[model samples]
Target: MSKRRKRKPKHFRGVYALLVFPFAEDFHLLLDLMRRFSAAVRYAYNRLLEGKGREELKRQDDLLCTFFRLNTRHADDAVLKAQAVLDSARERGEDPRKVVFGGRKLFETLRRRHLSGKPLKELKREWKEKRQGLLYSRGDRTKGGNLNLRLEAEDGALWLRVNLGNGRYAWALVKTSHPNLSALVERVHASLPYNVELSLKDGKVHATFTWEEEPTPLAATKENGVLGIDVNSDPYHLALAVVGPDGNLKRHLTLSLEEVDRAPNRGTKELLLWKIAHQVVSLAEEHGVAVATERLKHLPKGRRGDGSGRAFRRKQHRFAYASLLRKVHSLARKKGVQVVEVNPQDTSAIGMLKYAPLLSLSKDVAAAYVIGRRALGFKEKLPKGYGKLLRDERFRDHAQGFYASRVRELQAKRAQEQNPYLRRRLSREIGEAKRHLSLLSSLQGSPGSQREVTDGRNSPGVNPWRVLRVGTFLPLLGREVPRDLSPLKVFLHRGAWEGWRESRGPHPGGGPKRANVHFG
Candidate 1:
């Protein structure tokens, strides 16, 4: 046997930190610089979109450097930022022609916002409203440009020197009174960040840095175990469950989210989110395990046509799952914990159905338990009721067989019927029976994967078979499925496939094989 190749370990992890700046007289100059930078970036973006070739865009970048009177490096930065946005949109399947930004959207792009403590959902709304002006700027990543910031030792006092664009400098004293000042300054001095940002908030200057720290990547396997987190609303913000490699629950934790849930102010909500992030990181560190959470996606805007109240709609909008995940992942990385995301499908229902009774835990904790098991590559056993539903001979074999037999009978009747209208009716009935046979066969083989069974259905907690209840399951007692079974079925007077259809003829077979019928 050949030797196995060793996988390379990931090294650098990103960190965001804030440093305060003080200025009394040059505040107006700082604002002026922000406006000019924003204008230049917007112009470059529009020009980039209009250009058809990469070489042509490079030519335009050179012209912008002259027209904007910006340094060559700074002008190149603007072009790169524009290209990054266009590339991202294209990757997401968005049309490039419709991706133009204007109004408040353009100004919002001027800020280095990942460092902002605001929840991403709220920040997005504010970004799209009027002009919030520039609260921050991620200036050129080089050593000499606007974002070039360094802590200098002068006259035995710690001072921060920031290069404002247009070859200007602003100095601020590092106040010894601030609790985190020493730590912040020491980190910057050690890392010497490549990119820096300047922010003007509450009439005070602040500098933001995106630095890379030494990485402590986890091993390929963690025998100690995994941490599963379920993010939810109300009294408990998150439910965390730790499970061993053997798939047994080790511990359960609930983070109280009362303050964030009840907060009326956006700032307070943001602060509470920070505290939650810290808690998650601390827990992961204490356990020395990998972190896991549900990978939620394609969230609907609201309960469409469901008659949900205004308060309910507003509450749905305020819960930002993506932002909270970002915070937790970032903090966990800093502490050397590996983060894992598992598919969110059926996690809540499966937990409630299988593990809740055995562990005597709430549904949320049980769901977290399922998530942990998923991350560990362990299979969760189906509930006993689910197995019984699948094993029922009527559902597994007889229902589909009935439809198939009825389809054959109708085909024979269509051939014998003399009246034109009666022949057409027989043909239609045969087509309907064939279609139902296909659907039932699909379910018997793979119940949840069939388009007819899963389409337009979003009820997560209900049993999959129950969605086909009433007209579908009840039809077994009678000769035909009720009219209500197909709300959209039209009167099919024509034969199957209508006019000029290719025929492969019929199958020479016995009742479709025993292996296909029984799922156990």
Candidate 2:
């Protein structure tokens, strides 16, 4: 068997520290430098986009230095900062011209400050601090670490010296009680290279130290087992499953993201996410198994102006799926834990169809289990029960009929609906129902591997799995993706798929058009 290709083991680490200025003059001086540095960065960003190189912009007599009252090193740092920002924007496919010096959201919030019940002065102050109060200094190995802003460790404590330009320097105490600061202490004492960044927020100055290191060797292995994770947005939770070497579930659990939702501020929320990431990585370390997660694709956060309910939009916005995954992947690498990204195709559908009812696991947990199994190179075969149901002609017809009835009812509802939002919602459901009708119309006589089949339905593809999901989830269950799928267990038994009887007569509560599903 071929071993997995190992990537370069590069580590990025950082710790936070608060800067305590001794004298008021020193505070004011540093604040002035930071505000100028912030302005210089924005100016440099625009200049960089105009094709101006750093060599011309970072000279001591250059306008960037003279106008900003910045030293040559600070001017150079500004250009570097601008280039980093530009590179990040391009990576995210964002319009570099539209980049806001201050965060766009924060700037936008100032316009509607009255709605937040906060004083306008306070709101503007927050915006100004973010937009103007910033400073950065890159470390140089030749200068015994950072040149413009060097860290010093004395008697188990840290201090920072800020070069104030014009032959002046100010010393400030680094206030942090973090236990891991010992590693930083050691690095500072050894004069290892480190980058320092300072920013003002909430009327206080905060500092972050960043450095690179070699990552540890991987200790966890797939041969031991795999810990699979799946993030769900609706309820906002992470479902995890520990699959053994034999592809059987050894354990399962879930971590709630409600606390992250309830956090009062962005800082607290970010800290909570990091805490959760640590818990996940710690579990993998304890199990001595590699972690498995799906390669994420861009998920549409429902537009608030249309399409989605307020609650749904809020959930999607706060999902943190990508954020938590990054934390887990990065932390795992630093700690020498194995991580595997599997193709996310059909993990959800396969789990809902087979394991959700078979093992009585929730849909999310079942999906996680499938991820772990796939990571171990196990293939999913269509269950015998599902294979038999797929071939049942009556089953296919009954499922098709359910959607056909739904489409008629939905179109009538949409026409009568006065509210635009409700009409749009109805129209969407009708479209889905019609699509299912088309899918069922082209059902094959036998189940086979997933492949494309076209027959005037304008469908790109049809497979046994899609047909089964389309037939069962909405037709008999009346839900596209129900939270509790144990109800599907009954249909998993013999003759259950085609075994549903429906009354076409007038319904007891509504009308004759509604078909009441009854499982026999």
Candidate 3:
């Protein structure tokens, strides 16, 4: 065998920190510089785009001047700084223009011009003093130790003392290299303070500043494991599951809005959802595990009609699921945890049907059964008498035969039905229900046979109840397993399996042999 090649680990590049600092007198000067830089950047970008296409224009600078709704002048200043970097780069044969600009200077300039009225000289002096304090009081660097500073003008504002330290200060240099250095600086200053806290990671410098108010740390990953979450409206539930070393569920928790309401009201469900997602991310980071959820594409919606049936009036807010998934996913990524999405179709209901008979019955017994199994570590617990169950083969034979007969009945019924839409719907419903029933029936005879069966008609496949359960718990189960019985096997047994011949050549015995395949 050929030697396996070692794969390289993937690396990610991102802004490690967006420092925000309070506006000081010198902040005005920084703002002025940012405005000029922004103007320069814009001018350069426009000049490049005049003769170039979109792709070329984007490549012409390290950072692009994307305008935001908050401040027009600041946006314009960003453009100016971008232009300056391009011009400077072209003159010096260095791609300074390629450096993405920060919004520090732009915000400072705008704040000075439109919000605050601090004088430039006063602000400069204060900044100088602050630098001196950092050098002397903090003992970080000696005074007059090769401090590099520059002044620039482009967006009707002036920038002064844009300084970079020698080694760790390389980040400062990168920050200032942007055409819109002022804007970049303003953003940094807004987010972080000077010499308050700083660190370097993966070649990037991160800094934090003291602020009176800060957003509460969101719910995060714990050292134990990540809490897998599934978001829904009305009955907002969280299926908190822990992952093991092999990346399978170790323990599962099912917490709902009702449970939350049982305690004193902390906030609205939306707030709770946000907190939960953030906490999950934080926990994942702390625990060094991955948080998994389902990737929901188009959600089922109520059909528009004469407003007669419940189907026509079912209100499903697609945004809630989309937003929660997005928030959790993004938070997970930021916290350096894996956020995965699995298929959402029948994860919960199937699991419930498979594990219910083993649990004590209650209202919504099917849902509770799966939740309890997951919580009790059933997935990790192998059946006690697997050898006996396999040796008997009776359950398997009965399940296969039943599935085969039901498949034929549904196929025939589908073919005879005249209404195309109704025929397809009923066929799918009956087929899936029969397949599920067959699996449950087979599992019933196994060592753990507490699996419960729910009425097919009452439990629509995509019903919210089913959706919430599946989306919440499926990822916790880790991987899909082949059901003991399915329509595919039934079709094959009846010699009516479509696409079977296309899949492979005839065997030496001149017939196809049954193969096990897992469907999710």
Candidate 4:
């Protein structure tokens, strides 16, 4: 009999197991331990800022070890992690000297400010003032840093240990009796932890363990599934649109992340973030799709102009768009789900104008729809009622009259203004109004015997401008046109001008044919 072959599992996927302190008594010991370790990291960071290289830092590690009362290995890990952070900062156009150290709070602050679009100078100032941070590491096959902190599930009990570099280690028994934490403990028993982080939160010790497993691979194409999310500030924190493989809406969800917003401290904020991350991963995994988010990397810093009030600035500072994206992205990566960032321009406007009324969705939900459509490379939808307004002669006449009156008013204003700035502004407004009037007149098929083409595509010959104008503005009026069709191509396809001249009599050759403006 032939032996059956066993297929290897997929690449390891990362899952987090958060273990809270079982015994309240160990809290102070863990806090003091973290504080001293944080101090050691700060010391190495200062020396590195003073131009100390890895070799010099290694040689001087013992000096810091003595100063901070840390063991030799602990000191080495601190220097290594500090150097890594400094190198990363310098590479990202940030000054290494401005690096801060205040343990987990420092990391959280930087993350918050980065998402809030705080200026780099301001961030540096905050860090320079704080000058403290935590040094957390994952465990290796052998000995390593606190990030290398390890945990195991064996003999019906959870065993946690963190080597403090000498014969001494911080060991604890994590409680698995509670229903809330038992599942996480069982997971540890199933697989050895791949990474670990130890931190002091609210004066209580908490350890986060990461385990590796094979992820269910997601399809590469958008057809498989797509998740569109709109991050906003209000009653609903996230508006999500789930699209099926057939370009059909599967579900819509609005998540209220008020807790993340109302979080009173860094620890609470992180807890909220972790919860949100888990929710996102669960949704992505369930749908077997990629998540879509706005590309908000260049979001402007809060309340920059004179028009912005102090209250508005404070609100902007607390906006969580960037932080939310980061958390979703990090969790999604571990789950092997794809993340797509769509351009955020006009999403709200397009959503309000088109999808809001059609889908009977809220402004935020409509925007989420647009975001999803964009990620899927679908054409933007048009409002059903917009066509009648554009096609109505009364509406066209009213529009033209409005702009013409505006032009005259602006011209009068320009003449009356003695101030150069006011006059220039008036002149500019006058020119703009006139241009709009002219464009409208051309669109409405001009009143004069000799009609001047206002469509930007043509002139003395058969004007391709008519086709260009139709193609450009038709969509705004609920008309869908082929995107790849050029002005000349569209004109030829209709034989619009040829038919116009044929109707004018047997004159086969004449002046350039006036384009027929009536296109459905």
Best by lDDT: 2
Candidate 1 weakest ten by summed lDDT:
485-494
Per-prediction RMSD in angstroms?
14.3, 5.1, 18.0, 12.8
Candidate scoring better on lDDT of 1 and 3? 1
The runs of at least 3 residues in candidate 2 whose Cα sits more than 4 Å from the true structure, single-residue gaps closed, are: 1-9, 109-118, 233-236, 256-275, 303-307, 384-388, 441-460, 483-520
Worst 10 residues of 3 by lDDT: 131-140
lDDT (Cα) of model 1: 0.57
RMSD of 2: 5.1
Arrange candidates by lDDT, highest first: which order? 2, 4, 1, 3
Error of 3 at 137 (Å): 39
lDDT for every model? 0.57, 0.82, 0.39, 0.58
TM-score of 2: 0.85
Which residue segments of model 3 deviate by more than 4 Å? 1-223, 230-236, 242-322, 332-387, 408-419, 430-520
lDDT of 2: 0.82
- lDDT for 215 in candidate 2 is 74
Between 2 and 4, whose lDDT is larger? Answer: 2
Clashes of each: 0, 0, 74, 12
**Candidate ordering by TM-score (highest first):** 2, 1, 4, 3
Candidate 2 residue 344 Cα shift, in angstroms, is: 2.5
Q: What is the Cα-based TM-score of model 1? A: 0.62
Q: Please provide, for model 3 over 1-520, each residue's C-alpha lDDT reduced to its tens digit, 9 standing for 90 to 100.
A: 9999997433221222332223353333333433343344444466564554334333423343232121322233334434555666688675553543333354365457544445654455443332221110011123221122222233544232333222212213222232334443453334322222233222222333222223233343333344455554434455555555443445555545454344345446556656767776665665665565655666766454422234323435322567667767765665556554554444455444333323322113233333323322334222323223323344344334434554565677788888766675656646664654455344433543422223222332223223212211221121122222121222223222222234442222211221221123
Tens digit per residue, CA lDDT, model 4, 206-271: 555544556546543366777888987644378888887665678888888778778899879987
